[model samples]
Target: MGITIKDIAKAAGVSYSTVSKALNDSPLVKKETKQKILRVADEMGYQPNIAAKKLVSNESRTIGVVWPTVERVALTTLAAKINAALEQQKYHMLLSINPTKTAVDLFNRFQVDGVLVFGEEAHEEIISSSIPLLYYGEPGPATYPTIDVNRRKAIQLGVRHLVQLGHSRIAYIGDLNPQHSNQREKATGYTLGMEEAGYSHLHEAVDSRGLSWQAGYQAVKQLLSKKKPTALISASYDLTVGIIRGIKELHLTIPQDISLVSYDHIPEMEKLDVPVTAVGTPVQTIATEITNHLLQLASGKKVPPAILDVELFQRQSSRSPE
Candidate 1:
């Protein structure tokens, strides 16, 4: 049978109520006594029942993370980092892949201290909840803080990098869905960057069906045969992988024949046949930002919206067109 708090109290020679206070690290208990009680509880292998503890403290010490698209590599890494950060603070993280509304309802019922949703778009009928919610996208009137990354500036950095390499014609690869604000923002940045480079007519936009390598391959293939640009900028790490595949299939070499840049800091994206230049905030930076916001909300503090900017990285996949 598993050890119980009563057994721990008896072994430590403390009252059951005092054991409880010690386990909770209540200030009412003496530090030395609390340490001794905790050591005895640990030695007895007594695990505190979180459900019972929550009933008394009214804090679950759990944060809910809502991420519908588990396929995003960057987001997956970032989520893991954020979870680690929360764990360091003695808070547990709960992940939910349900739709926005369902996920919100689930967290609300679970009564997590706060919720972090990692996307810009929400469901058509998102239920309002009393739980403190923070979104990693555009700010909404949903009575919670929102954190956003400047995706448009990220793409513009990529385009500007290519332009400085003496590439006049450039193509952008991203989802053309107007509903996807993130993708649209990147495309907008590409257009603006092209105009700034005095090549407005040379700017090309290719729509990937989804943010995957397959989508990138097909989109780039179609564009390669129709209106090939001097350089290509992919909107996501997966899409960039696909673009590299498409380039190889077309018997083209990176930089020597075509320059390539992608919108992520994925290490795999840099280990390709021709290392890719990139333009986006590092995943660690984004993860740290998100963790800070979640911790703030957990402590009953107001958190304002955040939109982190992107930076460019030059690599072997790109060179001056001269």
Candidate 2:
């Protein structure tokens, strides 16, 4: 059979409460006695029931991750990394694909220590909850502590890199929805980059209907038909992939006919036939920051909204325009 606090208490010659405190590593327990009790508990193969402890302590040591948009492979990988990070601290992670309101309510009922929300698009309506909430993107009044990347800066960096390569005529392919603050910031960055480079004629904003390769293909094809850009700045990794396929279908080649840069931090993008020049914060870093912030809040430490720094990785997909 298994062992329990009662067995540990008997072996340590202490009360069950004392054994419980010692096993939990509570400061109230004497250190020497706690160590002795822990050693005995280990010998006896006693594992404290977290659920039962939660009933008494009112702390679950569990985090709820609300990621409604599961289509993004990059996001999934980041979430997994964050989950592993949290696991190191003895914190359990639970993910939900439910919408904001439902997810918030579910976490609330579960009495989770904190909630990490990842939304595809920013929302104006605030979600009121007693549990601490950390948003992964832009901040809304609903959540206080948010972790956002400098998307505009990243895109601007991409544009500058292409400009330095002597590409004067460049086009930007991005989703133009004004409600999506992240996309808007990227578009703004592209425009700022083009204008700053004194190549205002190259500023073409083709709207990708969605953040998919298909949307990218359709938008790029339309742009090529009207006016072919010598270089292209895509807003996301998926769009960049679509744009590359579209270009090839139209009998164009990377860095030969049309150079490309995109805003993403995906590993696979580098393994493409022509490595894509990507500008964004590393996924691991971003994921760790978000996870750390949530854990800090859970431990009653105050955290403020943060904007992560983006890194530009120059690759072979971009070169001087012919």
Candidate 3:
């Protein structure tokens, strides 16, 4: 059996009841004594019986994250941030890579305080649960409270920036699959931005067939084979990375040979060969917002759907076409 509070109490020279209070962080225990007990417990590698605690208090103090697409780097980063945020509020985060319905059902059985579902392209059948639910992505037909970033506006920001820089022949590279609503929204924004700039005839500039680095590389390679645009806007950070590689392989340079802008707000973009100009809601902000809403729901408070705004960060990758 794992080391228990009683073992910790023996090590710390405290009563079992005192150790239990200290473990629960009750104010009844003196601060110095509590700290001593905690240190002893840590040194002893005492693992608390969470199942027993849950049975006694009827609360697990845990949050379930249902992420169907765990492979997406952006989602992985956001989930990590959310985990940190939830930890700050003394809640443990449990990730489930199972199908959405299955994960929801499993979390319900575990009696987690709340559940957060990450959006995916796959349509999921609804599963009822008493646990409060929060969704992060396109609202769609979800009955749960959703927090969505303005992806269309994000793409528009990048497109408009290129337009302002006198890049009339602008191209967009992104996933064109009809089922990918988020990518579709960004593509629609690109069309709107192009139309607004009176470049409606340049519809051929948009390539909506892929979201991976290889897809971006191949898309750019194909574009170069035909007629390269003055500037290119990528729908995601991974695609942008591939675009940069494609440009390099073609003996082209950013902003000098071909200007580029990408979607998604991440600090790592700054470390690239050229600090990429990005447009989207910051991942940290999204994580914090989702965590706060989940906490509110766990407390039995109602939360309305939230739509986050996006912003453009102009960096070295974009400039007026030569």
The C-alpha TM-scores of every prediction are 0.89, 0.85, 0.93
Model 3 lowest lDDT segment of ten: 203-212
| Whole-model lDDT per candidate | 0.84, 0.87, 0.86
| lDDT tens readout by residue for model 2, 1-322 | 4677888899999999999788667999999999999889888888777667789888899999988677766677788889988898888998888888799899999889999888677765678999998888756564467889999999999889988999878899999999888889999999999999997876799999788888899999999999978899999888887899999999989989999998888787888778998899988788789888998999889898899999988889998887
Per-residue C-alpha lDDT of model 1 across residues 1-322, encoded as one tens digit per residue: 5777889889999898899899878999999999999999888778777666689888888899888687777677778888888888888899999987788899998989889887746345655878888888644456677787788998888888888888988899998888877778888999999988899988789889789889999999999999868899999888988899998999988988889999887566667878888888887788789888888887889987788977888889989874
Give the C-alpha miss distance for residue 210 in model 1, angstroms.
Answer: 1.1
Which wins on lDDT, candidate 1 or candidate 3? 3
In model 2, where is the ten-residue run with the lowest total lDDT?
A: 136-145
Off by over 4 Å in 2: 1-49
lDDT at 238, model 2: 81
List the candidate 3 regions with Cα displacement exceeding 4 Å: 30-32, 205-208
Return the candidate ranking by lDDT, descending. 2, 3, 1
* Segments in model 1 whose C-alpha atoms lie over 4 Å from true places: 1-4, 10-14, 21-46, 120-122
Q: Specify the highest-TM-score model's number.
A: 3
lDDT computed for candidate 2: 0.87
